[model samples]
Target: MSATQSHRGVGSAVALPPLSNGPHRKRLGLVALIATFGGLLFGYDTGVINGALRPMTAELGLTPFTEGIVASSLVFAAAIGALSGGRISDGWGRRKTIILLAVLFFAGTLVCVFTPSVGVLVVGRVLLGLAVGGASAVVPVFLAEMAPFEIRGSLAGRNELMIVVGQLAAFVVNAIIGIVWGDVPGVWRIMLAVCALPAIALFFGMLRVPESPRWLVEKGRHDEALAVLRSVRSEDRALAELGEVENVAKEERESQQIGWRAVFSNKNLFRILLVGIGLGVAQQLTGINSIMYYGQTVLVESGFNESGALIANIAPGVIAVIGGVIALTLMDRIDRRKTFILGLALTTSCHLLIGFASMMLPVGNPIRPFVILFLVVAFVGSMQTFLNVAVWVYLSEVFPLHMRGFGTGVSIFFLWVVNGFLSLFFPSLVAGLGITGTFFLFAVVGALALVFVVKQVPETRGRTLEALEEDVTTGAIYLVHKNQG
Candidate 1:
């Protein structure tokens, strides 16, 4: 092909493919949707704890500190899960790894549903965390590799969309259970047990989806990779993609040493890892999960009762899904760096709004709940639309083929660790400092994260993964300093 033709083909693969009229394209889209249920389960489990904790605390007699532990233990374990998940996916294949995560999800949900003590509950949560971490690290990679570059952003983005959907699912389910079965001593168990249903769906779904074609190439199964790619893409497109994957694999093996060590040995790789971790940590520091995982309780403490809080929490979930839809539309249009920086700025302002609202509107004020809840929704909307999908897509796309797993694992591990710590202490922070102080702290972190993102991150939109990898691996992005220094 001529250079112009080659550029066009690569562009089609990278941009979101326009809605297709063909059966094959439709089939591929459906397959992507089905496989993304893993993302859904991940979103649900993490968010369910937000509302479930209220009843779980009462039943389990959890102190504020213990409640923090219960909430955060899974986050800590998820870091382990994200780290280990990469190696496992690299070896077992993405499909098998997802199936394994489904099993963990089922078992963890069962443990939590039946547990009589807080220790057992925490154990179940840790197991669940492992699955969450693994899914977070692997699912986006799986989707990205499987999707046509044309629609890759939106298709790979579907996982993030499912994440918000899952959160919405959790909010809806928690509300129904809390309101209808509010009198039950252990209603929280039922809330958690609901996760098992999706776990079952995800397990069976994985059995049907093919392994990632890029993974097959990494394992030297080029024929198999091409076969898998052909199922989702045109024959010409599949062959082209296969060549790209193989070329990268060949160059990667020549260096003969590609792993987490490469992250440190190569300054460029190390810089990419730092950027990845910064994105993950910054995404968390926005306190998105704090809202998703604890929104109901926050609403309750702000003055709404159990039923009112459950009903009110839906606002954020609704906005989250809406934001995700908006993100899907903008994934290809907005520069990734700008979206993230904009997200931090908007979310920081929301935090300030929330803090000020909480402080100005006394507990007795009827407007307190609406104002705080609306601001929380605004925060969730801004985050889901910008940072959430962009970070995952960038992580999945930026790394070279050989070290993709390790790079993603390192990034997500720290992401989950921060998430875990935040999950653990946020409630206590809220308890001790009240909403104003807690949000003030988030605002400060948000500002700091904004600075880091603006200075360190690079634009990744409209570039093929291979092109991005080439730029990243060669220190091309940072080469401007060659003359300056």
Candidate 2:
């Protein structure tokens, strides 16, 4: 039960515990459903702008430059939220942090709905961004810590599924409101207002769910941790897992490697942080968010009129939800490394096809818009299916328990930063390079991402978080494949 003993056992075979059924399983399912409301809010807040932007531009007099500012301001703030939210969650506890985020979400939504000018709207978005970023960093970790290793992938992945579902809801609502109230002034406010309902739900929901058992253990509240664990796990398995967690937690405390200082000074911790950051960066560079935030613009450039593009944008959102469902089913069955490799390959190919279609079909061609739309949908579907959920789940589980929050927060900060830059400049890129040239650039970036995954990303599937933590902290994770080969 010592740290040395646990570290030595990292390479040994450890069987996954059987999933418990009955009330305990239902309790776990309900917790996942409630917590992922954060993901839902993240999706709706980020995606609502896709349809709302056109009408908002007309009413608010948003020049192209100012439009970029309005769109990306939330993303930039999210980067700040993500970096700080992780550390805050570590100190404040995951449950309390999520409750605070819910309050932010509701307040931010109200601000956006009521704001009369561009400046006020930007301020409102910054508030929402902080909540979104915090949820991105915290929700998956909460789910992962709560789940049994047997179903951790799917359970944690539900947050991503909820995210896409929220995005789809935004798209559907935008289409309904935009078409129905096409003549109504400030219809976009209604679109922004709908998210407040889920924010309220998340607040109340967190109050009912138990704090993460692993987090309770980390704080040295052993009896409480076991109590929470028993609600979701079989009693015998709960006790056994508690022992494993305590052994690792003890070693982490004894070593005194817990925060940013430890991350920088320890070579293994630093390498893994880089890997997490790399994964985050790679996911954003796929150019998926570019479509999510500006699908209407992209479709317009491909030849659809503004109204047509607004409706057409729903295609990608629908495909994204479907792909997320598919990905969740495969999460536990497939190797994490294989999912990354295949996802990168598929998404990169889709990018190339979209670029070529734009060049070869031309804007005036009758089929051009439809072709581009199809390719965009394919790109989104591939990303949702293979990259999005898998990346979040991997990031949540890859770090040592002591530094999980810091590592996840830092990695997702880079993710949001890349996404913000892309959102900010996508208009300029489209205006200058045209759809063909812009997507070609994304294709090139996608190719490089494929290389990064094949070379640097480690396999995390089918391992307990503690075992994975052991390998990650000692740098043994990188050598596992080679030794097996």
Best by lDDT: 2
Query: What are the C-alpha RMSDs, in order, of all predicted structures?
Result: 3.2, 2.5
The candidate maximizing TM-score is: 2
- TM-score between candidate 1 and the true structure: 0.94
Span of 10 residues, lowest total lDDT, candidate 2: 1-10
- Residue 332 lDDT (model 1): 71
lDDT of 1 by residue, 1-118 (tens): 1211222212333322233345667768877887788899889999898788888888888988898899899889999999999888888888899899999999999999899798
Report the lDDT tens digits of candidate 2 across residue range 121-170: 99999999999999999999999999887678999999999999999999
CA displacement after TM-score superposition, residue 49 of candidate 1 (Å): 1.2
Error of 2 at 465 (Å): 0.7
